[model samples]
Target: MTDEVSISRRRLLATSGSVLAAGAFGGCLGGAPSEGGRSGLPSKVEVTMTSRPTPKFEPRLTHVAVGGTVVWTLESGDHDSTAYHPDTYGPNRIPPDAEPWASETMSAVGETFEWTFDTPGVYDYVDTQAVCTAHEQIGNVGRIVVGNPELDPDAQPALRPPQSELPRIARTRLEELNEQTHSLLSDEATTSTEEP
Candidate 1:
């Protein structure tokens, strides 16, 4: 009787362990669930900020409609989102008519800040903290392209301020994002033209 009880207990322990391990592994593989809004025109999008090890923005790039809003969620450490405009002590990378925006420094996890893009253009921004941490030098930057705005010949970010100031990694990231934004705009243009 004692031997039988020991065997059953061991089997139960093994089964429970397997069940827990499988649950954890499955969750890891599933990734974060996406919460989307509208069809192709998301009303709101989120960008996560982290500062441990290094300060960075997850996704680094975001796209939204002209009136869409972007919410920055702090995941770790401190951060602030500031557009690259003369008013912010950075080059003019946002739309020529768009107003500069800067978020107050946030230090707690789960803290949030948001901005609405009312103009149609590509906007490049950085964490003002970059000045002290050299986050921009290390490629920690964020870009947002609103609507299907036509690219300005003379105001292209790749050829303007900050681009030359950024290091290889930051410049590379911007280049890749610029290509992606261009492709997206091109595709939207094609789609719109075909619709009518």
Candidate 2:
């Protein structure tokens, strides 16, 4: 009877130990944090879509800490948080370990797509959908700087994306936007007081 009890107790302990190990292992994986409170998933960052005097991301550049998430809320215009992954027809800029991820293209006002940056790097995204003929070529894009503010692309850390990708007007506009984002250059760099 004593031997049987000892065996039963050992089996229970072994089962408990395995369960605990599995739970701990899950956190180490690069998956989005399930227990955001316990696993250091920081509060989400938000960027709204704006279309009126200007058709662009409300905040073209976003900053977040590692493990932080960014949710792009579409206030207006058809948009998505399309990461620059091979699948998206651009070199990836997100962290090397991070998988290429994107929010579905949505146009309804108030629709949103969220992504967690589990690793550290810059994640450049674009809204490729055409809105009244304006498209990604016209500067419907944005970026999330994770952990490193001085971030470069994941694959070509040195080479920047070519300006030829966008229309001439858009390329110039995006350059101005990038300058503004890269530097605290101007709060109204993209904004124009002049009548369009």
Highest lDDT model number: 1
Q: lDDT score, residue 58, model 1? A: 69
Candidate 2 TM-score over all chains jointly: 0.60
Q: How many angstroms is residue 193 displaced in model 2 relative to the true structure, after the best TM-score fit?
A: 38
**Clashes (N, CA, C under 3 Å) per candidate:** 0, 0
Sequence-dependent TM-score of model 1? 0.71
Q: Show the colliding residue pairs in model 2.
A: none
Candidate 2 residue lDDT tens string, 1-196: 6999999999999989965764453222222334334323334567887676666775676655577877778887676677766776465545566677767778789898888777765556677676566566667777665553442433423125434655666556555545644452122223223317
Top of the candidates by TM-score:
1
> 82, model 2: CA deviation in Å?
0.6
Question: Model 1, 143: alpha-carbon shift in Å?
Answer: 1.0
Show model 1 residue runs off by greater than 4 Å: 1-39, 130-132, 155-162
* Residue-level lDDT tens digits of model 1 in 1-196: 6999999999999989966774453233221223323334455668889976789886677766678788999998778898888798467778778888999888889999999888867888887764467666667778877766776646655324345655777777777767766776676688678665
lDDT (0 to 1) per candidate:
0.71, 0.59
Clashes of 2: 0
